[model samples]
Target: MAINRLLVLFLLIINCNLYFSQEVVIKDDKVLLDGKQILKAEKISLAQYSFFSVKDDEEVLLYKYMDNETPSYVNDDFFILNFLTEKIKVESTDLGKVSNFMNSKKAMEKIIKWLLKERVINRNGELNPDRIVIFKEKYDENITARTLR
Candidate 1:
């Protein structure tokens, strides 16, 4: 019985670690998730909008969105920057020409610069303390809600 309990406890620990262990690294204008390239820099154009999609066979782990505040009547340009396992959605008309912003590397760099300017992350792509605090609060709220459920 003790051995079984130990094994279960070990498994639970490993599961928890896997759940929270997401390492986001930006290198050479490419986003690497756990050291694997996930962004393909390809565009999917539709009648209404065109945006880049994540690489095939990869899970989305991080996401961000931005807008240039262009009027609704005009065609808008946007970017999708995926860091690790999620999506980064950015749409801005003032971001310059559509063709240039459509490139995933440019979009990712633009968003990363914005993140740095906003102090959300340090120059090395690590989350700053303020961002960490926000994350902790969200985690606490999530845990509380789960317990209530």
Candidate 2:
């Protein structure tokens, strides 16, 4: 029994190391995954739907921002969504006023920070696929109703 437990623990550690071995590197207008250019960043204007697209070889990461109220110019609650899957919507109300992130560098930096904080992307710059599955199974649809418009 003890030997089985040790083997399990060892396997767990190896798995963790594998996951953490991946690295995400951000350069000017480029997102590098494990030293390869996987995405190119570009700024755009799409009203409330999106601010930019981080285009990878096979997928486009639409970076969206939703303001929940009339343009008060202050205290307007917002949500940042759609980096990977639409199932996850991050409330940015407590994070302060989110304006149009038009600068590619700044926008990508902020997006990466949020992704890291939310664990949507692992430290090695890989998407946490489990987040999508978990969110789809348990995410609240109504939480985004106010911002959908």
Candidate 3:
């Protein structure tokens, strides 16, 4: 009876760990967000409208579509750099153009510079890298918040 009870206990612990683990896996070139294999890009694009965990995923899209002010949290290091949202803007551009903009190093630098100039991100001249949760729509006012911790 004692041995049987110990085995049951061990199994229970293992099951609990598996239940709460947040590892996303990718197989066959498909990305699995929290064990749900994303078979199509449409699903991913739709899912981008909602706030989701940023673990094991290489890229994320944030959608902001409301006009109410919301709270957000940023890493202290990033906060000091002032990389928070004061305003957001979206443009009527194609996905290809948007993708190119995001991938362009020069564009990214310009964005960072603009953010620093506007006091939206760190301007202390020290790079305090932290994950930033950003809303996709511009001037929508609704802010979705997330934390790396």
Which candidate tops lDDT?
2
Candidate 3: residue pairs that collide: 81-121, 81-122, 82-120, 82-121, 82-122, 83-121, 88-138, 89-138
User: Lowest lDDT 10-mer window, candidate 1?
Assistant: 42-51
Name the regions of candidate 3 deviating beyond 4 angstroms.
27-30, 35-149
Question: Which model is ahead, 1 or 3, in terms of lDDT?
Answer: 1
lDDT of 2 by residue, 1-149 (tens): 99999999999999998886545556765666567664565555533323223443433345555445666563564445554444454444443323435544455556555555556665444567677545334433435656445
Q: Give each prediction's root-mean-square deviation over alpha carbons.
A: 17.3, 8.8, 18.2
Between the candidate structures 1 and 3, which one is better when assessed by TM-score? 1
**Candidate 2: global Cα-lDDT?**
0.52
TM-score of each: 0.30, 0.48, 0.23
Instruction: Say which candidate scores most in TM-score.
Output: 2
For candidate 3, the TM-score is 0.23
What lDDT tens digits, residue by residue, belong to model 3 across residues 53-112? 233332222332221223342122111112223223332222222222333332223333
Model 1, span 1-108: residue lDDT tens? 999999999999999988865454456534555576533322233212221224353433243333325435344324333334222222233344223334544555
Candidate 1 global CA lDDT score:
0.42
Of candidate 3, the 10-residue stretch with the lowest lDDT total is 74-83
C-alpha lDDT (0 to 100) for residue 42 of candidate 1? 26
